[model samples]
Target: MTTLFELFSRQHVYMQEESAPGFAPACLMRVNPDDWGRIAEAARTENCRWVAAWGEDRGDELSVNACFEKEGAYAIARTGVPRAKPVLPSHSPYYAAADRPERHIRDMFGIAFTGHPDTRRWTRHQAWKEGEHPLRREFPADGHPPVPTAPDEHYPFLHAQGGGVYEIPVGPVHAGIIEPGHFRFQAVGETILNLEERLGYTHKGIEKIAEGRDAMALARLAGRVSGDSTVAHAWAACQAMEKAAGMEIPERAEFLRAIMAERERIANHLGDIGAICNDVSFTFAFYQFGRLREVWQRVNHEAYGHRFMMDCIIPGGVTSDMGDQVTVAMEKQITFLRTELEGLYNIIDDLPSLEDRLDTTGYLNPDTARAFGALGYVGRASGMAFDVRKDSPYAPYNRFSMEVPVYQQGDVATRVKVRAEEILASCFLMEKLIDELPAGQIRRDWRIPPSGAEGLGFTEGFRGEIMTYVRFGDNGRIARFFPRDPSWLTWPTLEKCIRDNIVPDFPVCNKSINGSYSGHDL
Candidate 1:
């Protein structure tokens, strides 16, 4: 559990351009260029996981930053390349989760990861030309030249076949009101041998859309990244911006933000547990949980001004203020939710069929969970207790009591139990926050962060750890903003978890480990 600075200071590794910023206690370690592989190897051996990667545009160059963290230590590795030739070493060989984001950066900024396994276009559609990158400073947003005629072609997909090993292609479009992402399954009979995911079809060009936006506008965009995680995402984005710009927020604002975040957690987990029950055809559990979730979100809208609390968090502080009336109402709702959840848990735990169906199904070993850098409930369910709020405390979370639940079962049933436990924990936290709600202003003036400086914000969202990496330019505009949604790691875990499970049971397993396609695509 040694810090990155200590590891370098102890000469276990070499570091360059190290800076200790006065604001937040973070070690700005500049990774030496030639030793990337060695560093990657050491990071893996030391259990350090990849945090995120982002590229900031200079006049003629792109500055790429790859960040890694373990315990409480964070290291940011910087590399730059000419705008004309944006190429760098790929970390896919070392970290499996690096593949999608690497490909995404390539698609957005035309940055190339030389050894990336799958180099096909990720987010670029027919809107842009071959060499054009949307995130580049000079890239035009409107009135581009007409695209030349290239014959319409089908997307190339990996094929698998060996007698019983056949392919099953699922949706880019599904039957339900869900986001689009294609799933290619290679299975032997009902047992999945391999699964390849094709995501990003719903890419809203959020980064592209956020250009030239003010801090408030950016907060709205951040909340919309994944609708279910509005509070956490907006809070995280503002946390980074507020820290970077040296803004001070009121204590009341911080507490309100935490309450909103915890409520979001409770609602999402309730929905997930219900959905998992529905997936397993347990009608009673599904209906009961769904009713509770519906009531919960309604209370959120009434108390927070938005159903999802979108734009509730801004740069300097929170946008929404909670009065005593709303606080009292929330406590009442929480009381009802606690009673309902206890009853539901009692019934669910007593159902032998439900227990048998979920137990040992869709297992993800601890090693695989850590190797993939899984986060949140899924990670916690598999013995990875890396909650950003607790592991890397921020704002109101630091002032409050927190307990992160962990389970070592690493199966569908274990994931369910962990999520249920988290739901109860969130209720306790929300109640405490309401009771001890501070009194003060909710918003403060915000200034743009100075140029050429980088900072990362991490939050424990309803799903897991949501990491945002940002770098500002001289013009007081964002040079690069890379958000690493927990969905990216968790989605792959689903593929691994479905291995020995039957095709019919896939629905239950999938629902239990739901990962957002839109969030990951971004």
Candidate 2:
């Protein structure tokens, strides 16, 4: 298998180069700015997908990078904007996934994506003054006066002028203890005509805090980007840091990281499957899955330090170490889990009502899934065979044998089944890692390399592939760090999936395809 770096190196040598201000490789290939349009066309033609688009502030300017992926590799296309006027073309017309990130960059850096469908504010609020951009280096966080709020303005959505069309607006503050995000549903009675999501009410400016921070500190912040994804994000950030520092983790440490990651996956999947069932009014499934998830998290806290395993991953290696005794206990737990899972599957499969609620609800057809660039169960359910652990094969994943489960239904049922199968698969994989149990030190000192080198890291988080790119400053601080959560892709798919579904089924559909609000808000 070839490394992403190797692929980029080959492409760099063959492609034409052009310079942009404040960017590392001033002379990057100058595809026609319209080339973005062409690239989108090619991805559709060749059956590929867009992942993310984010900007890194370079003091004097901003450099935006958009990534697209195929089966074996991915390409990052860069577009630079001068610090004076951070403006660029919009790809939302072609790929719907570009909508949020472009809005986010606009919110944080004041960069504008011209021709974007909706050019409204995302993360910025009345906290900052009219001329202020909180994330910019020039904007100070100290002693700022509270700004006045503008009179509420109407959000103009696309017109659905049919006789039966009506609008339904749901929460910025929810009934449950979830994050704030508004969902605007345009529907004809029960059937949805269109869905527009408004998120970023909880934006924490994680990227702003990341600037100038040391690698070790950044790992802590990265882990907290989304509490549920603590292990994955931290692992990605650490992988990038280790690469930039020219350090390799010990073989034993790598295996431990993988173990932590697989465990994280199991915990989340169990909770989600149960929650989805609850949304469909399947109390038995919900209770069983919730009880199982509680056990899973409790085990994590017992073995590691936190229930969510927050701070369990560090720059050089994992913070928690599993001894033989813990390994034995885990083996026994796995045995019990496997048997319980089989029984649960039999129960779920026997219920025709459960299948009816899930089988075709919130369906994202294959073409739509590809165009929207969905990942994880959303993509896998639509017949996309992309799994970072299987395709990219990072850390101990490369050391083990595995299979990526996929289905072609692209509905709520398919998503649930994919998650369930993956949980079982991860249990088996973790057992293998624990059984072979490498004997060695689990932690090592990471040396910070002299400045100017950049590093890229990718991990298959429980949700999907989470990516981080970092370029170190002259003082070994983070000059530029961009982390893309899988939610960036999955969120757009949610909007697409809700189309044509009954208004009442929105709860089950939304739960089945749960995208992180906090992670995306960052």
Candidate 3:
């Protein structure tokens, strides 16, 4: 296997490792815009995972940054195009995960990614005019009054050519209170021939609002990036800011962050397991799991004052600390949760209806999962073994034993099993963390970084790898902030997995995957 460093150096890519102010070292490659395609392809050929890709308008020119991970380290490939031209080749041909993001860049920054297949507008469907690029610094944060969005029905979708072929168009607005997204399915009779999605209905102009905000403001906004993944996003944002500021948080804070993260993970998994079962009309597990989740959230509210732990993580450290009473109470809850979860699993494991609904439904092969860059439970179930906690160790995560439950089945059942196992693992880990809760200040005083300082935050959210990039400007303001949620990568893979399955099974498959619309929309 060729190391990413050796591969890039072999091609004389003009790359050098730049140490982040207080975090991991990142290899920064300076390449011509024309050569970006070739270098990006080479990186992918060497088995590198695409972490994120974004574009920034820099006065006279536009700069594009592509981040990749290999062997527990990160490398950034960068290039610039003339502002007037703003054109560069796309990396989507080599890395599928780059497709949507590149299109988003084209929509927002007017940076044309040449050679991109299916270059139709994504993320910006009538949100702006043809030539208007929202993230170009000049666009007002609060744009002109909202205009009625044109009907998105004209968007081209692949047609299934056959006598029995028909198209089923699901919601950009659903009956349930879930976030809006359009899903198009081409099917022959009951069997699905294809699945395609058009997301971004909930785009909140997050990246636009992030500009010029201070560290605390940025962290607060990051928590709202995706409601369910709030803790993960805030922590990642703060990590990047702290690194840029050269700030160090206390050991106790790191442990507390981990505990909060694990709790978040467990809560989501429990809800998902129930929801997936309920999609098959197995309301028993749904009620039981919902009960458990309610109790869990009550505790979160009592202990952290937030049901989802929002705003708990801040730059330089956490916002608060836990007392011995909370620790003892949390331990008791964990013990009870473990006993209840085991009993529930035993019954669920014996149910034939669940087995039928889950066993081989919505199968996403390992090869497909790998190509699509699936993450967290979705990737682990399909045998794509990559977990940020284990592979890219950070803080207290590196200090603990991380057991990533992997299953090769690649079906709804396998995904559910992985979630269940993870919940159990989180329970045990939480117990360990509380038992060994060290004594130290939860936060540390810190100074903001000078202009041009940059850092990146990588964390394993419940959904999977989340990357938050931060750069400070003059007067402690943010120059650029990009939070790449794992949902961006996982959502595309949903289309591939649903093929050949019947239309009725779609809900169960979707619930099992449960990619975040808001997370991906941003």
Candidate 4:
């Protein structure tokens, strides 16, 4: 396979000699706005995955950056357009995953992707005036006071017009305590023909609020990007910051961080498996898994001081450390979890009715999974074998062996099975990390780098890959920060997977995917 750098060099794309500062192995290059589409096309031809795209508001022009990955190497391509008329060709033609992100950029920074098939307003659904862009430097971090705006009743949703096709609109406000997102489904009788999602309702302007925050403050904010994935997001952001500052944390901190991440992965998978079962009315599995999760999190609080492990990871290193007793307890919990999980799995496998409900429902083909660049269990269940820990090992991961579970069925059963397998794999990793606990300092004094330095960081969150980009300005403050949660990619795939399934089965299909609404909204 051709390397990322060579692939772009073959296209005669002008790349900067000095690579961007990041823990992740990547290079930065400048591309002309006119050549953006060509660059994207080249990447697609080489089978490179589109990572993320975001816009920065420079003083005179709007700068757009697109990231791609191939063979464990990353390429970040940048281009600028005049701020007055921020128009450029779209990459959505080459990578279907780029469609919504480009629309998000257009919504936040007023950049126009001229050839985009859908010019609909994505993130900005009457949140601001017609001409106001929140991410621009001129826009205030604290916006003007709230004003009464009309309901989004006029927004256009695609109509599936036929003899018996009718539309069913689900909630922007749900009955349970969950973030709001509107889902429109066109169905003929009980089977869904198409599903479209409108999902900016939970937007909190996280990107705008991140400007000028000190290193510590920014790390806290990154932890909250999506509450459930706190450890992964904070680590990604801190990795970016530490790399930009040319700082390496102590070896002991690295081990502790990995332990937290694996525990987080296990806890979330347990909750998700239980929730998916509950959606299908398998209450026994739901209650059992929920009980296990509650105990797991309670142990987390006993060991790490926070049930969710929030604010435990800071810029230089982790804020919390484990003692000898805590390590022993954690090891014991891992053993207990494994034994219980195996017994539960055997019981679940024996149930023919449960198997009947899950066998072929909500199938997502590998082709669609690849086209959308899906991640985590969503992609793994569909036969995409990309895992950051195994593919691009970092720190503690580099020191240990990793195993990734993959399935080709791409159905609800396959997805559930993948999660169960991952939980076991994480238990194995946690055992290794705890047994090899190092004796050393957990953190080092932070050193500030020069202004205008940029870095990128990524980690495999429970849902999938989490990528963060950070640029430091004068006074060591964050000039620009963007966190690409895995949900952004997985959410679109959910819409595709739900088609042809009966409306009653939609809950199970959706619970199987479990894309984060807050993470995507940001």
Flag regions of model 3 displaced more than 4 Å: 1-3, 11-23
Q: What is the per-residue lDDT of model 4 for residues 1-522, given as tens digits with 9 covering 90 to 100? A: 656768977877665534566634787778888888888988998899998999998789999999998867788889999997889999999899999999999988999997899988998887688788899999998776488654677789999898999999999899899889999999999999999999988898899899999899999999999999999999999999999998899999999998899889999999999988888889999999999999999989998899999998998999888988898888888889989999999988888989988989999999999998999999999998899898888898998778899989999999999999999999988888888889999998888878987778889999999999998888998899999999989899988999999998999999888989899888
The candidate scoring highest on lDDT is 4
Poorly placed runs, candidate 1 (over 4 Å): 8-14, 18-23, 125-129, 142-153
TM, every model: 0.93, 0.91, 0.98, 0.98
| Residue 238 local lDDT, model 4 | 91
* TM-score: model 1 vs. ground truth: 0.93
lDDT tens string, model 3, 170-252?
A: 99899999999999999998999999998988999999889999998999999999999999999999989988888788999
Best by TM-score: 4
The C-alpha lDDT values of all candidates are 0.78, 0.78, 0.88, 0.90
Score residue 110 of candidate 1 by CA lDDT.
Answer: 85
Question: Which regions of candidate 2 are displaced past 4 Å?
Answer: 1-48, 125-131, 141-153
Best first by TM-score, ranked: 4, 3, 1, 2
Better of 2 and 3 by TM-score: 3
> Candidate 1, residue 362: CA error in Å?
1.0
Ranking by lDDT: 4, 3, 2, 1
What TM-score would you give candidate 2 relative to the actual structure?
0.91
lDDT of 2 by residue, 1-522 (tens): 553334444433233343322222112343444454554455445555677777776678777777666664766666566788777778787788787788877877788777788877766655555557776777664426565554223545466777988989898789989998889889998999898887777777677777788888889999988888999999989987887776878888898888888889999999999999889899999999989988878888888978888888888888888987778878888998999999999998889999999989999888777776677877898887788888767778888777888888899999999999999999999989998768887878877756776666788988898988777887778877778888888887888889999988999889887899988888
